[model samples]
Target: MEDDPDWGEMVSRHIGPHQKLRLHQVASVPEWAATADLSRYDLIFIDDSKTSELREQTIRHVLARVAPETVVVIHDFEIPPYQNAVPADFERIAFSSFRPMTGVVWRGARWTMPITQLAERIDARKHMSPLRHSAWRRYLASGTGPAR
Candidate 1:
């Protein structure tokens, strides 16, 4: 999910062309937290950019709403402040020094599939991109499904 329209649009242009992506942009984190069906997502990226004034609150809301089995990729997790904000149960499932990002597993699961293969499946099946809305009702009603 992304809050910035410009970034969201860019993402649509890029990721949308190569892979299916349902981009959700919400005016407020609370609205998304209250309305989004977190169970639908297998992979979720929570952008913790420095400029998003709502960073901390947004992360908290995402964590609260995200399903236990979902994989959460927290952007900029290397940052001291952001690292401190993550919940204890979220195990660091993937991280690379070449990338300043981190992937977290919310719950333990018995899986034999390689992580890379699972990621590919999740990306291919992405749907439900909800654009930011001014009201809770609108937010609940928003989101674009992956193109057929």
Candidate 2:
């Protein structure tokens, strides 16, 4: 999800896209979350919030709606109270991004083969290149599967 249309395009270019994917250029993600049927998506990427509090709220809203197998990728995951906001029952894995940091969170039996494979392919050391040298980038670019 993204609030700004231009940046949202850049984000879409960065992550590639899923046929089942849904993008919401919403004004208030929390408000949108309040009514959105978020359960249908297999993978979700959130670089939407503009502040720390909104970020936490966005995550909580997503967590409340998504299924256990849904892949929730959050940008700037290592930030202060943002990290604190994540509950103990969920599992999060950090990786590189344009922010120089990103993380994917999930609950339940999250060790699904695709999820585990994505984690292994991601470069923990560098941001993705639009040129497609990154395995993780290529993996998504190919539309091989959802991050789940």
Candidate 3:
């Protein structure tokens, strides 16, 4: 499910021609969760870019319902509140790129990489506008850190 129509359109344009994608646009995550069958999907991705805690709660709900083998990816992984929104049991798989930074969470299985190794790979860099990056850096420095 996609939260924004513009993003949905962008995704449609990029993958629509090459892949058969079933895109569903909802007003918010909670709306989607109400009707979606959690076990039907093998993968789930969320644009957890909102600063709202309610959005985080919705994400948590989605995570709770997914199967253990399901792969969940959260974008804007470095943003303050969003970055701290993941569940405690899930392991973070941070990528090398920080722009529109990405990270993975696996709740049903053991993480293939150790924490130290994963830490080495999550390179924090510019992912958003300069102003937003500055603000996010300050937010992290405040010691709130990631939700894990």
Candidate 4:
């Protein structure tokens, strides 16, 4: 859920009628959760909340109810707090080459094949922004470095 209506509307306008999606601007993640069915979604992507803890909460919230095949991605995973947000039992696939860096996680191993195919299909290296920040440098130096 987006917090700003104007930005959300702009995004919706950019999305146009091509994508089968609806963007909602909710006051908080909890508000959106109140009416949405997590299990029915095949994929879930949340814009990073104002804080890392909130982002983690949102990530865990989806994992708790979504299907095993569902893939959830959130932003700013290159930061240590965001990386720590991932629970120990789950495996995270990090793409630290991107500007904000992305983290992909699911509750079980069912995510492997599809993510692997997607990684193959999407050439992240070509789209990679040059690394300039210390945070990203540290993330790349760590074991959870980008697949590319």
Candidate 5:
């Protein structure tokens, strides 16, 4: 269950009495899904670091094991690779509802970028604006963008 040695140390340092943590790393979801008894767990945390195909496959595998009421938390759902990977059945919880102290620790220094900042930037971008319009115009005139 302890695939990452530092994870145990990190959890111990941060988590207090009320939390119970379990860690498991399987080479593939099918391996974990085949062996795990999901009835016992009220919650499951899935990390979507795998390819889109693999992530979708894992979700289906997990869904088969867990009960309807079982809560599933998926990580990296905001990143471009997995942004559209969320299943339609699962309700999207607002980021503000969960105050996470997440950061990137590089060379023993903590670097933080707020999710709000990223969201704001995305919101400000004009879809099919000047850049895209110009590109489309060039593509139509020269047929360069379209694959032959």
Candidate 6:
């Protein structure tokens, strides 16, 4: 997890000896590496607390670099501070958006992901054929229609 200097040390200390952790002070997202070999990690979780422009740029960078199978989980999706903060350009690229039916109080607001939308995506992906997988991967890479 990428974080500010103050939080990095505390987070690393709490994770303890068995876990591996590295801390780097980066002023902005563009300063970070443009590519990452996702084969080493099962999931990449992004906490979207930055400005809309930075968040969109970071998402695009990650999407281009990570493998198709890599699970990219983003937080603060339903939080008011983050919801509309996502720029129009990023929203256009996303295939779908979700919000929860049940809300949880966090940061003084109730936030959630809609259960129906989540279930639909889960079901659709589950039934996807090998061809479909390949097509979706291509779509993600090129930001265009699925492969023929």
Write down the TM-score of every candidate. Answer: 0.61, 0.69, 0.63, 0.70, 0.43, 0.45
Q: Which stretches of candidate 6 lie over 4 Å from their true place?
A: 1-3, 20-25, 79-148
Clashing pairs in 5: none
Indicate the TM-score of model 1: 0.61
* Cα displacement (Å) at residue 43, model 5: 1.6
Q: Indicate the worst ten consecutive residues by lDDT in candidate 4.
A: 120-129
State each model's C-alpha RMSD to the native: 12.2, 5.6, 9.7, 7.9, 16.8, 14.1
lDDT tens readout by residue for model 3, 106-144: 764455554334444233423434356566566455544
lDDT (CA) per prediction: 0.59, 0.70, 0.64, 0.67, 0.46, 0.45
Among the numbered candidates, top lDDT falls to 2
Q: Report the lDDT tens digits of candidate 6 across residue range 1-148.
A: 4536666667667766554444445665533526555456444555432575566566556655655344555554453433443333232112233333211111111112433344444335543554476665764456433344
Candidate 4: global Cα-lDDT? Answer: 0.67
lDDT of 4 by residue, 1-148 (tens): 7867778789988888765576777777745654568777777886746776777676666666666667778777777876776678777777654457777887677777767645443344335445535644554455354634
- The residue-by-residue lDDT of candidate 5 on 1-148, one tens digit each, is 3234566457556764444665544456645664678777766666533365666555556666665556555554444333344455544442322223111111111112333443333233423343465654554456233411
Give the TM-score ranking, best first. 4, 2, 3, 1, 6, 5
- As for candidate 4, its clashing pairs are none
Residue 6 accuracy (lDDT) in model 5: 62
Residue 2 lDDT, candidate 1, scale 0-100:
66
Task: Quote the lDDT for 28 in model 5.
Answer: 62
**Stretches of candidate 5 above 4 Å error?**
1-5, 16-19, 24-30, 48-56, 80-86, 94-148
For candidate 5, the per-residue lDDT at 77 reads 48
lDDT of 6: 0.45
Per-residue CA lDDT of model 1 for 1-148, tens digit only, reads: 6667888788888765554467777665545665677887777777734354456566667777787777777676666555665678665544433355565546565332455544443344434232322332342334333333
